[model samples]
Target: MKITNVEFVISAVRPDQYPVDALPEFALAGRSNVGKSSLINRMINRKGLARTSAQPGKTQQLNYYRVNDQVYLVDFPGYGYAKVSKVQRQQFGQMIETFLNDREPLRMVLLIIDIRHEPSKDDILMYDWLKHYEIPVCVVTTKADKIPRSKWDKHVKMIKTSLGFHPADRHVLFSSETGLGRDELWALINTTIEEAKAEAAEAHEAEEAEETAEVSLEK
Candidate 1:
């Protein structure tokens, strides 16, 4: 996907602040300083569209970025950081839970993790929560270039094992610094978006058929 028009739209903390355009939204979720911002920059081919911060957990809201006016890449606040207050953490958690549970435009979520380490407890829990919601997910392990090419499989295996990776879930090894797996991630996002649209269309058609049948019976 050649991205041309990518722009930071809004930083929304409340549900009412979310974009009304209803574009398919792909969310990025991960622990603090796990390079979620860098992954977004690399994916969009922009240097600073998603700000990389030295202070983890600086993002306290759902940041929405519009791509080609076709979809929105939502950069969620990084979780599991210690610097934030308990109240702040709780607020972030509630915001994220609400969006994931109720948002209609959300198409897929990309759970980012570090390639060099085993998936953290938070990572595992996040993955489980998404699965429980039956939301489509694509696990993205970033900083892949830090690891040796020969050992990539071993690290990926460890992550999968620790997370109890479901067969239906997708996983991709990524390197934000080197643009690795960027194209593949985009492809997955596009495919997920199309599939969601198709499902919605089919449901609409079914409803229409039922309504028509009822109308004929009444007549």
Candidate 2:
């Protein structure tokens, strides 16, 4: 799919109101101020496509962006904000859990983390929660422009080991400023959508077979 067009659609808080189209969705997730919005803007080659700010916790809702009129790029609120009250944080946690568990249309999550620092506690928890839910994820290390090229491997390995990522999961280095890892991320997104669709089709076929067997037994 050619990414000829991209536009912001809405910021939704509830799953009942999410877009009902059959288009595949890739959601961007990360801690507060991890440059998640900036990365989305860079990938789509549009400035301000996703509003960016130095302030953490700016994106409070699930922001949806349609690309080429075929796929969606969802931006989720950031986690691990120190300033947010405990009750608000708990509410946010529940909101995210509901979304991840219920949004079957979501194909994969592009989990963004800063490359300069070690994975925080919230990061680890997020990783584990996704794995538990069986939602496919690709961890993207943002702000690569700040790190030296020679030290990239060392940092990547550190993040990988800390998160206990499996052999199949992918980890990519990204930079919103210099446009690094853009193509790689897009390719992963496309593959993820295809894999999810294939699995769904297989499940549908199996259900049909089971229904046919029941019909034969009735006759």
Candidate 1: stretches off by over 4 Å: none
Q: Residues 34-139, candidate 1, lDDT per residue (tens digit)?
A: 9999999999999998999999999888999999989999999999999899999999999999999999999889999998999999999999999999988999
Q: Give the TM-score comparing model 2 with the true structure, all chains together.
A: 0.92
How many residue pairs clash in each candidate at the backbone level?
0, 0
Instruction: Report the CA-based lDDT of candidate 2 relative to the real structure.
Output: 0.88
TM-score of 1: 0.97
| Model 2 residue 98 distance off true place after TM-score fit, in angstroms | 0.3
Tens digit per residue, CA lDDT, model 2, 1-219: 356899899899888779998799888889999998898888888898899988888778899999988789999889999987788788788888898888868888888989989999989999988998888889999999998999998888899889998888888899999989998998888887778779899999999999999999999
Stretches off by above 4 angstroms in model 2 are 209-219
> Of the candidates shown, which would achieve the greatest lDDT relative to the real structure?
1
